[model samples]
Target: MWLLLALVLLLVILALEMLRFVRNMRTIPGPLPLPLLGNAHLFLGLTPAEACLRMGELAEKHGDTFGLFLGPSYSVMLFNPRDVERVLSSTQLLTKSEEYSFLGRWLNEGLLVSNGRKWHRRRKIITPAFHFRILEQYVEIFDRQSLRLVEELKLRRSRGHAGVNLGEAIHLCTLDAICETAMGVSLNAQTNVDSEYVQAVKTISMVLHKRMFNILYRFDLTYMLTPLARAEKKALNVLHQFTEKIIVQRREELIRSGKEQEASTKEDVDDVGAKRKMAFLDILLQSTIDERPLNNLDIREEVDTFMFEGHDTTSSALMFFFYNIATHPEAQQKCFEEVMSVVGQDKSTPVTYELLNKLHYVDLCVKETLRMYPSVPLLGRKVLEDCEINGKLIPAGTNIGISPLYLGRREELFSEPNSFKPERFDVVTTAEKLNPYAYIPFSAGPRNCIGQKFAMLEIKAIVANVLRHYAVDFVGDTSKPPVLIAELILRTKDPLMFKLRERVY
Candidate 1:
């Protein structure tokens, strides 16, 4: 009798969920979904690049706002800037989507995925780590790493290599810079390109990407039985062990130098001594919540977050920036001229923060690149409470998908959206006015990227350094552009090749 009663209760709950799903289907416009599977079949067996194109087709068919169901989970793709504003700008709707849970084993409660009070507390603690004073110091690391990359590229040009892959080169350059700045140690990723830590990061990221899109791998019970699970475990072990080891080493160095105690006593990072620079890990080590210092696990999560976020995103931005300027010779020349005028022709003179600030034309080119190929092609958020977004009532538990890729290409938002025009972002050009939410490469509002300044500074430094040394030209056919793979970061399926000619000013 008890078993029968329990079965009846379960049926009733399932019935109610179906009713809610029906209500959503009636309210929103999208491709008709089959029962049980919904739109999951549309995405199944598709590569990330193919899947990205498929999403574009769906948006074109369903208008700005549409609903899709992957299994039992319902997601509303917000293509309209107003709807995106309604979701991203809301403080109450800050919870990440279920899709982000794929990163749980690796990132844990890191700032990127953490929500509610935990996110709030962590954000507050980590914000100061990117303050202008600290960022000013990071410029040294950026200049050094970028110079190393420039030398490597120059070496390749000398060896009769007509083309260099900017994608691979920038990834290593950014990795080296992030390691030194975030952990106060050099993995020398640019030098030791085959390091165990670098390989583990790549391995784990690939496994996570595979799991995120595969409906069959969503659940832990089923996923654990798969071969990818073994790869995930091994990669995660290497990642966690490396992060923990670095955290221990950094903390010990801080203690021995007496900077850890000094940082703890200080109310602000600016108050910390100017003689010694603090890594992001050092700041987390000194930080406390509810009067208790954060342990090794706490420090590791934030550091690993920095390591992942800092390098990958910046590398994507740089790759696109290189491709954009390489294709647009006029824009590339303008950037080269600006860099020469601002930083001078001396390639040996490192790009300083002050010099980087003065390259206004280069800044415009960087902005355009971000608009065209945002590092994070898509952003996801989950609705915790039933909320009215852009005058429509979206039910709670619905996933929100905001694609910067689609938004950037909307003809209504940007004039000549398909063309690469750096002047589109120039303040004096009024061809099209931009909504703050419309062109969010670094995102917008309260939960916007805290390290945006750091990213911009690094990008400009690298671009200026490269342009100052070499004239870059695209190596691919204009008619056949590289296919974009919308993974953790936006990347092309093929390497973005560039030919560099040494410029003698």
Candidate 2:
């Protein structure tokens, strides 16, 4: 009789839980979810590339805004620009969603993941590092790296105009450029493609993507038992050690040169007789918040954040730009003409800040590419307070997802949204009157990407340099789009191939 009573009590508890779930489901429209698992079954075993496609399909069926449960977490996907702005523009919703906690082991409380007071403090300290004057100093590094990339392409073409994976090559070039500009260290990653640090960065990104989609890996105890976790541990060691070494070396160098004291007072500019300007790391070393200087850990976290954000996102954008320009011959030619006009037909001439600014047509192409394929397809925030979107009440603590990827493709916003038309960005056209929140490839409002200007400059420098030295041609079917995956950034499931023909003056 006692055993029968215990069984009855268990059933009562489960019935109550089911009743609560049903009541919550009535408020939102989405696919019916299975108990306990929620919608995890739909995404299980799907690659990031496959997952993005699946999400798009669901969006088509469920409309612009829908709700789903990812293992008890109520998530609302916002594809409408107005809905996205409602969440992103809120000061109360500034905290990143729980999914970002996965990155805390690597990024810590860096500018990308921190919230509230910590975020404000770091943002204030780091904003000066990207000032126009400081970015001008970075232009030389961008030019040098671009030249190296062009040289690499030339060497490859000398053998034959064989199809080359420009995506991988551009990633290496960007990695090298960011390392030099952000850390004041030459990784030579463009030449040394198989470096350990490069491999570690790649490994960490893959592991993170895997953990994100696999619910089984979301729990700490379960994840720690997996082989992927072991690999992640090793990769973190490599990444942390690399950044820590750079931080220590930079600090020691400042102290040895007796510039440590001077750094705190002097303007962040190149020293009188120095050949190289101070890097982003140098600025961090001198920065303080609340009269307290940043410690070594703080310095490493920021450096790591900058290195990853600075390289990966820009490389992804450039990959899509290459694909767009290569497929659109007219646009490609127009960009080439604009580049040649700015640089005066000298392939060896370095790209200067002023010269980069003049490549107006090339900038349009980059912007168009970003519109079609934003590097960061989704941004997430935790709703800290109850909010209303499209007349629907979004309860506090709900996870809100904003997709720039979907917003950019809305027919109501852009005519021929699927087409690669650089002219859509012309200042004289109606595109100039479009809503600012509508075309937020770099996001919008207060929490937008701080490195957007730096990214654009780097992209323009490389694109101009490449077009001046080589005529890129598509090697595959131009009619079909590449299969895109939502990793930490946007990526292609397969290699994006292109043919580079040596340009004749």
Candidate 3:
């Protein structure tokens, strides 16, 4: 009789938990979720790329805002710009979603994932690194690397451009550029494609993306039992070790040069009107928060964060830029003409920071491409306090997803939203008429991307250099678009193919 009573009590407890879960979900409209598993089964047997597309489809059917469950966690996805603005613009809602905690093993408390006072302090310390004068100095690096990329492509052109994986080649170029600017170390990732550091970065991202969609891997013990988890551990060791080595080396170099003291005092700049030789890592080494200096582990987190953000995001945007230019011949020719006008007929002439500003058409094209294919398809924020969206109550602890991918393509926000018309970004007429929150490729608000200016300069520099010499054409089936996957950053499911032809001036 006592045993029977215990079983009844256990069943009653579970029944109450179920009732509470159902009550919490009843306020929000979404696809019906199954017991225990929730909506996780939607991703079964689907690749990340396919899953991304399916998510977008669900958003389309469910309207602007809807709730879903990833395991037991109740979350809402916001597709409307107004809803997104409300969540992103709030100072109190600064905490990132639980999904980002998955990256803590790699990124720790870096700016990308940190919250509250820590994030505020780090943001202040790192802001100076991307200053105009410093980015002006980076232009020389961008121009030189772009020239190297041109040379590499010329070599690959010998094999014909029919099946050339331009995306992979561009990724290498961006990786090399970021390593130099961010770490002050040359990995030469473009030329040395077999570098362990480069390979490890690639592997870690793949492992993390797979883990994200697989609900079973959410628990540490369950994940550890999987082969992918072992692979992730190996890749992480390689990545963490690489960053730690660079941080130590950079600190030692700064002390030897006696610039460590100067870097700590003020913005590091030379008397000759040129920026100092300091990189992002150097700034982090010299930075402190509330009288506390960052330890080696803290430094490593920021360095790894910058390296991942700087390279992967820019490369994804560039790949889409190349695709857009290839498909639209008229826009490509206009862009080429504009680049030639500013850069002149000499293909060997280096693109300067000033010259980059004058390529108006090229800038428009880059903006248009970004709008069409944002590198980060969605931004996840965990609600810190109870919030109301369009008269609906969203309780605290709910994960809210803001999708630039869906918002950018909304017909209400953009006229002819699916069309790749660069003219829409024209500064004078149409651009001023649009809403700021509606077109957030780099996002908006105080937490908007600090590296946006640097990204723009890099994109313009590389695209201009390529268009100065080569005219790109789509070699694949033009009817079919490349399958897009949203990991931490957006990516193509397959290689982005383009035919490059040398232009005779």
Candidate 4:
């Protein structure tokens, strides 16, 4: 009788809580959700691309702002620029949503996932690593890796393939560049794309994506029971071991050279081959927060974070850029001509930061590519306190999603939003001013990407080198575009195919 009375009381409390949640969310227009399941059934077993499309369909059916229950979590997605600005611009709304917790195993409390005081401190420590002088030195690494990419593509074509998936090639190249720049070591991912380290990264990413959508796999206890958990564990071991090894090796090297002290005080350091550059690892190894030097674990988290963000996002941008320019021959010819004229006709010539800056037309095309396929399709934040966004009361504890993918395609924001028109970003010549919040490929406001300049420089280097060597053309049916999936970073369901012909100067 006592146990039965306790069970009844627990049930009553749950009912009251559910009723309060319903009262708060019902005012927000959205699809009528099923009890307990909420709107999860709509996304059940859907691919990331299909799920993204479903969200888009819902946005069209409802208005700019809508609500949904993702498992037990109530989320409100904001599409309008006003609502986006309110959330992104606020200092208090900096905490990442619960979904980011899934990355905790791989990234830990790095700059990407940390919040409040910790985020602020980490951000400060990492800021100097991207100093203009430091980024300028990384241009050499970009030039070298991008040339390697061109060589790899040529070698593949010589092997008698009619067309190759240019995306895979780009991925390997970016991975190589990031490893060198982030950790002061080379995985030679371009050469060994099938290495254990590479495969581990891929596996972890796949597992994380599936876990986000699968309700049963969301909890730690239940997730560990599944087969994916084993794969994830193996991958984590490989990744953690790799990063920890690099961190130890880098720290030891720095200490041995006695330049470790210099790195802490100065923005630059003497790297291998007499190159004056500081890899992010060097800075972290020497950095002190509150007068205490960062330990190995802290350093590894940031280095791992840098490795993931620095490579994948830039690789995504390049892949889509290649696809877009290949499909538009006029744009391709213009970009090629710009590279040849500004950087020189010699395909072997190294592209300098100055030359990359001179390729104004290519810059326009890169911006346009990001606009069409922003590397990060969705930006999410958890509301810490009750807030009013565009006259709507957004209750605390609500997960807020802002989709750059859909935001960039709004008819009101861009005329013919679907077309690949580089001229649209010609701010100097065009009279129509763009709303800053509407097109946030790199995002905007306080939590914007810190490595945007580094990414831009690397992208331009690839464009200059690749276009200097070959004339690229998309191989697939133009009408049937590759299915896009947003897995942390945006990617196609399959690698994008392209034909690369050596340019006759």
- How many pairs collide in each candidate, listed in order? 0, 0, 0, 0
TM-score of 4: 0.94
Question: What are the per-residue Cα lDDT tens digits for candidate 3 across 1-505?
Answer: 8657755664464454445446666677777766655676777788888888888888888888888877546789988877888877888788989888888888989999999998998898888778777788888888989888988888888875365677888899999899888888888988889999889988988777766667767755457778988888888899898889988888888789886666564434333115466577877787777756688998999888888788989999999999998988999989988988898998888898899999898888898888889998888888878888778788877888888887888888888888898889997756546777888889888789989999999999999988887889878878877778877788888778877888897
Candidate 2's residue-wise lDDT over 358-461, tens digit each?
A: 98889889998999999988888887787777787787767888888888888888888999988888887644456667788888877889999999999999
Candidate 4, residue 25: Cα displacement in angstroms equals 2.9
TM-score of 2: 0.93
Model 4 spans with C-alpha error above 4 angstroms: 1-21, 266-275
Estimate, for each residue in 1-505, the C-alpha lDDT of model 1 and write its tens digit: 8657755664465455555666887778888766556677899889889999999999899889888877547788999998888878888988999889888888899998999899999998888888777888899899999999988887767764758887788899999999899888888887787999889888887887777777788756558889999998999999899889988887787789776665774375567625567788878888888867899998888888888889999999999998988888888888888888898877788888898889888888889999989999989999888888877778999888899988998999998897898888888864667888999998887789989999999999999888888889899887666799988789998888888888887
Residue 278's lDDT within candidate 2 is: 67
RMSD of each: 3.2, 3.9, 3.7, 3.2
The window of 10 residues in a row where model 3 has the poorest summed lDDT is: 265-274
- Pairs in clash, predicted candidate 2: none
lDDT of each: 0.85, 0.84, 0.82, 0.85
lDDT of 2 at 350: 88
Judge candidate 1 against the unseen true structure and give its global Cα lDDT, from 0 to 1: 0.85
Candidate 2 weakest ten by summed lDDT: 265-274
TM-scores of the models, in the order given: 0.94, 0.93, 0.93, 0.94
